[model samples]
Target: MKLATYLDGSRDGQLVVVSRDLSQAHFANGIATRLQQVLDDWAFMAPQLEELSISLNHGRCRHAFAFNPAQCMAPLPRAYGWTVPEDGGRRASDALLGPHAPLRLLADPVPCAARYAVLHGDVPRGIDALSARDAIRLLLLAAESPTHTAFAPVAVSPDELGAAWQNGRVMLPVLAMHNGRREGGTDKPEPGADFGRLLSDLAHPRALRAGSLVGATTAVLVPAMAAGDAVRFEVKDEAGHSIFGAIEQDVVLEGTATE
Candidate 1:
């Protein structure tokens, strides 16, 4: 079942269940009004919301409306912490760090962190004392192409989640960038990794972390950005089932001194 957050003219948009075909939507009016609330209590709320989704598909539920990607927000606008694995220059450029060869911003915020972080969770292994919501959110952005970094929906059962880590094999589909840049174009898309490999890569020490950037990627896409450029990020399916909808603001270099 696909879940999303739509704009209700509020800071935290209202939660809703989107049909598989993306032709319809059912409001989560009674069942946790916010997406984070739903994520916080996903174990108990998902099934209930799924039931409502079934009803909506059958025309039994009320207030079903046409779904629109334009009026959506990131599944989790801000995450507790952020971790971005080293790109190795396979899917991105190494020159993004403006003449700095060593690259000291791994532990700090990068342009991508400020613009794209979408999915959030308790911890790398979900052992944290905080609320347990481990499903990875795919932060979709308005890019020139698809990065294969979007989140694929799956059942969040303990056994299923654990299976993703066993023997370095995962049933989960990891979106990966592929091929090569086509004359100043973005990279292509393909299955990059299973759950085990992705988790391991994300935990790598050389990774970058930000308070707001939440999602994981094999390579950093937004290696660089300027002060005036408005680079937006979002992740949804072909049918527009927004996992993390999109970043609202454009990329702004807040007071980086001119030198």
Candidate 2:
């Protein structure tokens, strides 16, 4: 099932269930209002949302509407914590930007492709890698800027990925575009450090809170983005269907007229 958070002028946006083809959606109104609420009680909430997803995808929903990435926020507007692998296994916390949100920067910043997983529930300390894998609820594509990271339009469940999801890593190329032109991309390969092992290592020190975001950057590199430049990142299945929509943003200088 695919899920998204619609921007509703609140810290936590309204949760919506998106269709498989990324065309339609229905408010997760009665079932749940916020993504964090669903994450907090995933075992209870996820199944209900999944059923709604099926209905929307099959064109059986009565009130489904067009899914708009322009009106989306980060799947979790504000996560309990954001952790990313860096510098020999070091972790850091960062803020998140919504897909299609303008990226404001004071200086030119390199755009990097990223992948992240949203945790379903708290992870217990010293759990094994296999068990850690079970804690992952969904995966997303991301574009990493110096100040903050922006995510794709939706979060996709592992089961929805079919054979593309392999042992906690997505086996797909991360493509990058700069100013509407293809710049560079990372080819499909098994990640050296799968999410399960990363989570397992982190959980050894302390329990990880539910809704925490764990991310990793792909090798795709592009020129530093300047004001008015646009960058986009996406991953596709073998048949060329986008898995998590796309993370597309325009770069604007801080304190400039564009801002």
Candidate 3:
């Protein structure tokens, strides 16, 4: 079966596309539907859920259980808190999400256009029978993308969000790359004209001024850059210093440009 998944890191729900045998399916799962019911759903406990593992043949790994938040036989609304930034970069803002925040899926599930059955469960294993909801719930519990890096989405301009609404909040695709500029250092240069020194002038803040968007991992998302358009950024450091300057690249926004 071929499975394609779409995740909006900013939002809690996920969409999976599956193709198997000669069928296709689409599924959606979010914290609201699955987590809340787990608070008291004993039928989903580890004892029963463990049976699903038998299909895998090979045993699971250390991080296996950690892969799905929906699978734990714990309780309803199983507060799967805030996951830290995975990029291993600086987390310099107090506005970060807390660990217990909820993940919300924004839509419903439907059969896919491919040849696959949409099975869902917390444990990763093949199954012959699964309801549309159960499959997504389980997939939410079991699936993980090792390459999925978590990032904080920031807006470049208000129009980004405006355009996003018109696009059904599905076309905010962006490219990320390291800005390659070091923060601070020493040395000497022309009075107020040191280009290298001027680089660190950008501050790391939550609500930065208009233009570019920088994340905790230093991953930069460039929005729109046409030749000759003046690129600008306002850096407000931990000390609340605002250094306004022309940025090296166009501003980039993350996730649905709208929210």
Candidate 4:
């Protein structure tokens, strides 16, 4: 079933089960209140959620409203743990933000492709996938480094749009710009390690799992960014329809890049 966190006119929005066509929604009341809450108890909550989806689809419920992608938040507002393989960092940042992100890459964000994944649950049972539906998320951050990023306001999950890992790649449809150069492409990264591997990785020294990951893309490209540059990204469905909507990355204090 499709799920999202929408503005209920508050800071932490209400959790909702959106329609497949992206037209309507029914609030996930009682059963669950937030996306993280659902993720935290997927095995217990999913069955109940499935029933709610059925009821909403049958028009047997009230408290429903017109679904608005513009009023959505990242499926996971703040990821439990966010990791980008060696070179994919720059591209992930650029595509996630914008080409003008002002990334000061100590190393070229090319040559070495990487893996991306989201882990939730626990070290032993890390469930991974960005979203059951391909989603659009934005990260806006300003730090001492030109490349630091943070989560933005708008994020959308339209249900069942996320690409399944094929052969060994997860496609991240991307638009990038660098010094007036514009390009479009995909990023393929293994979502995350298997359960056993995840446990092993987390078992390493100083390896306390921070948050649960949801999903990720690979082959992200790194673009040169500046202080005033803007970074925007969107995730579309197989038919190229906006699922996550539009995320415009803004740079307030684009820092300088270092060696």
Candidate 5:
């Protein structure tokens, strides 16, 4: 099931269940108030949210409303921990921006097409690659900027990806658009590293806390983006349907005006 966090003038935001077609949504107020809350007790909470998802997708919910990416916050606005594979993997405690958030840059930085996963529970040390798959709660598309990073509108379960999710790696191409034009050499993008191995590598050093965010850059490359350059990242299925929505943002100087 697809899930998103709507901005509600709060750090955590309000949880919402989104429809399969990305056209509608319903508040998950009674089920859960924030994405992190659900993640903390995923085994018990997810099944309830999944039932609500089925109702919303089937048009059986009377209170469903239109899904708006503009009103969304990063699925987890403030993560307990954030780590990406760089220089033998880097870790940080940071806040993530929403998909529509403007990227403020002190200096021009290259935008990398990336994907990330939210951990469902703490990962034990020395876990095998195959066992690490159980730690993943959901996957998301991301745009990694030097100053900051922003995530797609929603987080999707592995089952939603079908054949594209293979052995802990998403085989689908990540399309990068620069200023409304495609940036890669071809229409399709190159897939990244094996996530299972990436996760296992991360867990080997120490135990990962629940709600930790882990990501890796895909093989697609784009030129450095200066002030006012727009970049968009997304992954589409064979039928041309967006899997995790899109991460679209414009790069702006640090002191510039932004909404």
Candidate 6:
């Protein structure tokens, strides 16, 4: 959904979603949900956490209290993913305290498998034509007054969105539940087990099973041209030296132009 968290600083317990528009959409678990989704044999963060060591991968920062549900309405910075930590690196809440953080739904928060099926199947076939921006817009419109359309949540990060899709995980329409229930049953996308391997498979599907980037390739991409989308691009020549190159990609929604 077109969701954004507004945190009130200079005060405690003042965290509330400033925009009624967003709250109406879906004030999801936000950071908490994201952290939980990715913890995977890793550390878990919570408020008042101490004396616990969190092992993080190189260049990967740990998200401690950054996942607080109470910190939703905090401001986000111009540069993405920067949060305001509280209690000396032990805890953190949202930063960039204000409105206008460009909140919007970036994807269908449905089960990853279902969403994938929609994107790969129904989307291209014209059953549902939505870009990440369109999804957010639909959410915002629905939130504005539940009469516009059905609601869906937006992801704070494209990777988070991709991770949900890669894992074929889904947030409940109005609730969240996980109890080993096989969602979508025989219709869910195949889970890749881990992020790194999933990403590798996504990037080079052909190199994986079926000998092509097109087979069973459930990778989802939020191209840079789309709203609330960003990516890191690395270039290397035949010798592995850095070199500039042009890359072309597209998200072929039913109503959008093909890239």
lDDT of 2 by residue, 50-117 (tens): 99999998999999999999999989878877776542343344457788888888687655555555
Off by over 4 Å in 1: 87-121, 124-190, 200-214, 218-259
Of 2 and 6, which scores higher on lDDT? 2
> How well does model 2 score by local distance difference test?
0.81
Q: What is the per-residue lDDT of model 1 for residues 20-52, given as tens digits with 9 covering 90 to 100?
A: 555678778788887667656656876798788
Please write out the lDDT profile of model 6 over residues 208-252, one tens digit for every residue. Answer: 111011112222222222322321221222343211111111212
RMSD of each: 10.5, 1.9, 21.8, 8.2, 1.8, 20.6
Better of 1 and 5 by TM-score: 5
Give each model a TM-score: 0.50, 0.93, 0.19, 0.57, 0.93, 0.19
For model 4, how big is the CA root-mean-square deviation?
A: 8.2
lDDT of 3 by residue, 1-259 (tens): 1112223343322322222211222331321133223323425542232232222223332222212212112111113221212233232222222111221212211110000001112322222222212222221111011211111111111121233222111112222221343322122211211111111222212211211112211212233232222222222223332211112222222232322
**lDDT score, candidate 4:** 0.44
Q: Which has the higher lDDT value, candidate number 1 or candidate number 3?
A: 1
Model 3 residue 246 distance off true place after TM-score fit, in angstroms: 34
**Candidate 2: residue 73 Cα off by (Å):** 0.5
**Per-residue accuracy of model 4 over 207-259 as CA lDDT, tens digit each:** 33333442333323433444445545444456765443434444444244422
Task: List pairs with backbone clashes in candidate 2.
Answer: none
**In model 5, which runs have C-alpha deviations exceeding 4 angstroms?**
86-88, 109-113, 185-191
Error of 6 at 205 (Å): 36
